[model samples]
Target chain A: MKLNDEEIALRAGELGPLRQWAIAHQIKVGDYLGARDFVAVGQAHIMADTESLGAAGVDWLERWAALPAEHRLVRIPTITDPRGTDFAHAAQLKQQPWMLDLERRAIAAFEALGVLMTDTCINYQTIMPPVRGEHMAYGDTGVVIYSNSVCGARSNFEGGPSALSAGLTGRTPRYGYHLDERRLATFLVELSWTPRELSDWGALGGVVGRLAGDYSQVPALLGLDRVPSADQLKHFGAALASFGSVALFHMVGVTPEAMRLEDVVPAGTSLKTHDVGEVDIRALQARYAKDVDAVDVVVFSAPQLSLVEIRTLAAMLDGRRATIPLFAVTSPQVKPDCDRMGLTARIEAAGGTVLSGMCFYQSYAREIAEANGWSRLATNSAKLTNILGGYGYRPVLLPMEQCVAAACAGGKLT
Target chain B: MSGEIYYAAAGMGRKVRAKALVASDGFSARYDLDRIRGVFSRPEHKLAGESYQGRVLVLDAAKGGVATAWMLHEMASRGVMPAALVLNRANPIMVQGAALADFTMISGFDVDITHAIPNGAEVEIDPTAQRPFIRVI
Candidate 1:
């Protein structure tokens, strides 16, 4: 398939590793976009729903209508991809009243298609992304980052598109990142501080993401001595996607695609560079400050809580209770283990609830929160902070330790 | 734990802490109400949800952290100590939603509490009033 001008331009912005991989793979170029200069590689969820223009989008819809009618739409909910928990697992809903609603939404979507329904949020590691240098639609910033930087696949920071447009027509807009040459580094982010903590590194991603633009050339991050842990990397990619319109970044030696600072963008060649410090992170959760209040529950999962997070919370709240309640959300993968170890019982005795699979951010609509008079929510994800306010609920953004501590106190961690 | 530290009429320094304090929940005078309220008061003398079922005390974490703690001292004057602890995170309206599911058992309910931690900081309710007040130092 012949790629469009926009697709060509986006591919041009890819980093060297991805760029080279695309060129060597001889992938067909998908055409039909408007942008002529730069196309940032983007991903698709179902791989066929996105369209280059509304016209194409409409045309594809018409064609889908004209089909023989043998095709079926698949729905994947609860878990974006299937890494944990089958698509039909009702145990989550049985255990948590909230899971009932979640399973309903996903089950309706996958009424027939039978989506993999992997529960893990990290699709790149848990599920396979489009082959190296292949263009695909995907959600989750970290997955997008991994696709563009590590797998040589290209995608955008898709929230709705990555999830919805995946099965519309089995075709993308035919623009941005679908071609070679659009993946080169355009902007340079020189990091002058050492990121000691995962949050700090995540902050760096946020700062850079905000600075980066639609046609962002791969960013060459400098000034850090240590590599972030996988979990920390997840935070970094997530934070970057939340603040900036970025899909990926290049941390010189840190990135799988980037090897050196010079490899990002040619020196002094109409390329622009921005510098950031630790301040960007402080501003991320400006809404939820230390102004402590009566915190009843501390939620640990949004994009699926991790085992480390679960263990840490269990330990911190090993023995504590406030005049409030404590709640923790973890993936089902670790739930049975937590139960077997009596972590669940210990926490329950101390007054805390551990939920698996379902999350409050999306699963708990107004009805549920209003039903229980839970007008307030506490969390650390900036995306949740942005969305919770729109739902007529109060969300408390705090650090993990403080969140659990607040829960242990059965009150706010002020 | 929910209750009132009932002070004797026209009395000073004399407090009788009830095991359960029942009141409407919209008390956000302080940004961090839990610690402010929890640090000083014991769990038994906290707040109760939906007509007290046991000898539970009700303490609002919203009132002045220190003021309420000191004021609760008068609760002892009422001879209502040795109470069970019931901490409900819900506003006054959600007796069932914010019930002490972590500690107390409901008659026919097994509620799973889901914690939504946004970037680690407690995602506060009504952040519009906060106006960039969080600090790192």
Candidate 2:
């Protein structure tokens, strides 16, 4: 990797140990990934939820946070992904005191490093949306896929550590999705059906993602009768990233880069095309719902709800009182607006909890499930379904309306 | 099989020898592991119910979320982690986590490392070699 003078100085320790460590870490990752040089990124989003970070990671961050502010502060705009727990609802969620203490410490550590606690996976909708052709270091898989595929920005799956390194240096190793050659579609998918509900869209994403198989392969969709709304694409992209570890995808005639099939696919390229239909989407959902007639809880999260999604959920829950616990998780940015618009009250009136600044899976999911005796879970998010299995939850994938009905009808699947 | 060796395209951390736990399944710390139990917890995973502690995990590809980047380091800090990770392909999260944890990892072999390595076989991994490799010892 070629280093500019500033990079050299940082490595040489003239820029203090924090940046020195950060640049060295970047260079190590860059050389391994075959990055020739660093690319200046416009922003960095870090996913440092306490669940992922653990005690060691938080201690590591605090070590840096104790350093001089000049040495530790980020060089560019750096934001956070969802935290481990929303403090206001921690007790209700049955989160232990230790978990809350860890979250507090992690938040303080991030704040000390001059990181903004955006606490959102829907930053593309709630915070600054990246423009086409822009470069960024985004941590959350949902954020990266939405920004890269929907917004036409460039990024790889920058995890928490790499994203923080980019934040410190204002640059990232130029490789993977940052290169134009890597942006071209590797596989093609012909959609025989267009989805309406967010869950179906997410189910479609899961199907396509399984076909894509890995981070390096990009899947371009061919038949979308209509352009998907931002919220629709949000669920699709989140599930795709979660299920496949895929970074970017293209939807022909819809997404910015793939305005046409030829735009994303190189000429004369005979791609292996897979046809996905309504049957495939239904199969994916059925696989999750198999043998689960009832659920202990219903959740709406993973990408974290946009204000539009919240409004839609609120409307669905009107005059409906939930017998089972239902959660509507949204970003902090949208929560205040949700409150002011009475959406929060409306959802709460229906016996659903409105959680902000935290996502379900990221918030020590296993412990919370054990604490609350929540074994079977129902959610509209495919991303959440894909994740909760290992955490000991039998997650049922359903549309939002059905999820609401289940919540109101004592967790019965009907 | 006593002295067979497989070269990798990329590697990091130091060399170590351990028993191989091989599977042709994708890996994700957050999705497939129970860190508290030191075993593969996800029922669908190929290595489900197997103890991964201190064993070299030979797997197909990296999968799922970016939490593995931090989970790797956290796992190492707890003294419960794989001896090394040998994969056919690696996503950025694995590389980033290995870098942060200073854990042994080597990926990108000409052949599928998972198939080349036999389960529970004694093996040696050298990530610092001119061409990093894992050998059946």
Candidate 3:
């Protein structure tokens, strides 16, 4: 592949660590991207969300030199009340310095273009639907679904370049996923159980991610509900993205990109099909939960907390005191609103902690993990489950309401 | 269909009449608008749970369902068909960061109940290329 000056720019940059990271990660901007087919780039950011591990923060400038100069930038949104940490997930703030750097980088990138720097991977909620067939690049694991099914947008599971490639050349290298042929299914997922919980879908995501990654291929899931939740879609989307090289998948009744089932499965393709059952969901859940002693502390808001969630926390608290320490992290924008409404005070009064600009998993890794030894984390985010589970932490999956009750009563959702 | 109820509420401190049920999990909505019709028919109702109109009910399908549910109960305490839905991140109710709970809620049960945040088609674009891959399983 001929190297363009812009593409080779990173090889000649000043970011020593980033340069090393690029090489270690085997990243090539132009090799997989084109100059005229793409638009923006969504990357990671710092707001002390769960993905960052809430240490301090990082700046994108750290790797700006290593990334293609023309790449656009957008800040990743904060994930709140995340599920659990999987192998890929380090303790909270595991990538704090890196996150802070990413945030700064996004601000600078936004200066050059309309970089939509949101904190939540759930950017699809805002009508910024990614269209199918359009090349997209993003870093958030769970958010990948929003770009695939809901918005019918397309993109490979982008890693390093996700921060700035969109602005570097206004397009991505037409590589791996740029073509329809690559989008065909290599792995098949058969549904035997209709998932009713986010965690259930998320666990399935983990199974599929692990199973499909056998040959660095993608899976086309059949029989999932035609109308699934945005969160569920993103949850499994992110789970699969982080689980392996899987950048895209197909779902029935949803994902306009896969209008005809053949668009996803295709004909004459090598298919490895696996039938999933309720037993699989239970097994995943059981595997996720090693052994929870008792709920002494409930930490939600691995991602940034939304106002509606804050309101829910307030109502759940209802001037009551939790038996243990309960924490919920909200975005900087909604912090004051929570404070003004006394929701913060209510959560605090309930013996629970509500903090702004920081997520629990990211911020309390060492302290919580160490203090609460064997840290039986509870969450619904599939990405989190993979990260933490990989790290040997068993998470108890629960519904949002049950998590709140546990926080209030200082007990287990189970 | 046992007919699950979908509820959305802002702060339980507020109330909505119950003429119908709000099924969409639009987190942007502050309260279910269809439940408002119950306000006139059943002045005694507060959260839309006790008595049922020939047409409606209430359910909390939004984030912080606890609070939204509380509000549903407090506002339509006398109504029928009020329940709390427990969805996880995979199936989270769609409510953007800055979107106000009160803004997205509509009184009419006619809103499209499609979840726009989970699929590739729902992501926003600003002069940038769409993400080419999503690990959907």
Candidate 4:
């Protein structure tokens, strides 16, 4: 990869050992991806929850943190994804002490390096939304997909190490979604029905994701009658990134890059087109619903709730009393607003816990499930449903209203 | 099957020989693995409940989450990792994970690599070759 004087200096250890390591890591990734050169990025978002990091990763960070402060500080504005535990609710979630210890260490390390502990997956909604064509090194799959597809920002699926490297280096390899030729539609998806609810939208995205199948295939979607809300797009993009490993999608007339199909689709290029309908979305939800009526818990998370989504939840739980635990996680930025507006109180009054700064799955989900005897889970998040199945839970994907209903009725779907 | 060989577009880490845990399903450390038990724990996955330790994983693509990029190195640190990863296609997350862990990985094949290699077949993956490949032995 071609490097400027600054990059050469960093690679040569003229900058500190930490930056030398960072540049080396970037070079390896750039070489593998065929990046011709490095491109300066505006910001970086890291997904380094304690569950993913484990003790080894935390210790590794601590090693870097031990370096002189000047050598380790990030050059650009760097933020974090949802942490593994919300300190306020760690005991309630039944996370082990060791997990908390590791989280604290990781947090301390990040702070030493000048990273903001935003602890959010929905940073696009809560933090600054990237402008069209803005370059970023974002770590969360949901963040990458949303920033790339809806916000028209350019980012690849930068993992924890890679994003941190970019944060330290202030640049990333120009490859994948950063390049124009790679952003063109590889597949065409025609929708017969636009979704009515968030879950339906997520199911639709899941169907598209499954069809796209790989990160390299970009899908161009059509047939939407109206514009969907930000929360709607959040669920759709998160599920698509989760189920398909896709980084970007173009909604023919919706997203910024695709004012029309022709804007993203090159002339004379033939694409494999598939049609998706209401039945397909229903089938995708039904696959998880199979013969399960009772759940141990109800959750509203994955991409943390927006203020509008919180308002909707508060309205649904106004007169209800939940017999099972219902967790409603939102960004730290939204949590204070929810509290000030009494949304949090209403949710808590209905036997629900409005968590902040942490996603449920990123927490020690399996361990908490074992502690709470929560195996049958109900949620409105298709991305969470797709993930929790591996963590030994039977996750049923339902709409927000239905999930609230289950929580109020002793976790019974009926 | 012993002499059959398949090539990959890119590769990393040292050559490895292990039994192939072949599946057409996608892989993600955060979504599909129980690293503590070294098994594919996701119920919907083709290799659910199967142990993946020290085996060569033949899968369709990398799916779900950015956590795998760190989890792979964590798993390798504990010495409970797959011998190598052979995929039909790989995402940036997988490549970054393999790079950090210094683990054997090869991806981008002409044919469906999962279908070409049978499950339980002893395979030798040479990622250091000028042309990286996996051969059924």
Which tens-of-lDDT digit does each residue in B74-136 have in candidate 3?
223334322211111111112111111211121112222233112112111111113211111
Question: Each candidate's iRMS in angstroms?
Answer: 25.8, 0.6, 20.1, 0.6
CA lDDT of each candidate?
Answer: 0.42, 0.94, 0.44, 0.93
RMSD of 1: 21.1
lDDT of 3: 0.44
Q: Which DockQ value does candidate 2 get?
A: 0.86
Cα lDDT tens digits, model 4, A43-136, are: 9999999889888899899999999988999999999999988899889888889899989999999999999999999989888999999999
What is the DockQ of the complex in model 1? Answer: 0.01
- Residue-level lDDT of model 1, residues A301-354, one tens digit each, is 544545666666667766676345455655556677788888878777766677
Clash counts for the predictions, in order:
126, 0, 143, 0
* Candidate 2 segments whose C-alpha is farther than 4 A from its true place: none
Cα shift from native, residue B107, model 4 (Å): 0.6
| lDDT by residue for model 3 (A228-273), tens | 7665665566566544425567775566756666777657666778
Tens-place lDDT digits, model 2, residues A1-414: 999999999899887899999999999999899999999999999999988899999999999999998899998999999999989999999999999999999999999999999999999998899999999999999999999999999989999999999999999999999999999999999988999999999999899888877899999998889989999999999999988989999999889999989999878999999999999999999888889999999999998998999999999999889999999999999999999999999999999999999999999999999999999999999999999898888999999999999999999999
Q: Taking the tens digit of each residue's C-alpha lDDT, what string does model 1 give over B24-108? A: 2212111112221232221112231223322332222221101111112222223222222222221111111111111211110
Q: Which docking band does candidate 2 fall into? A: high
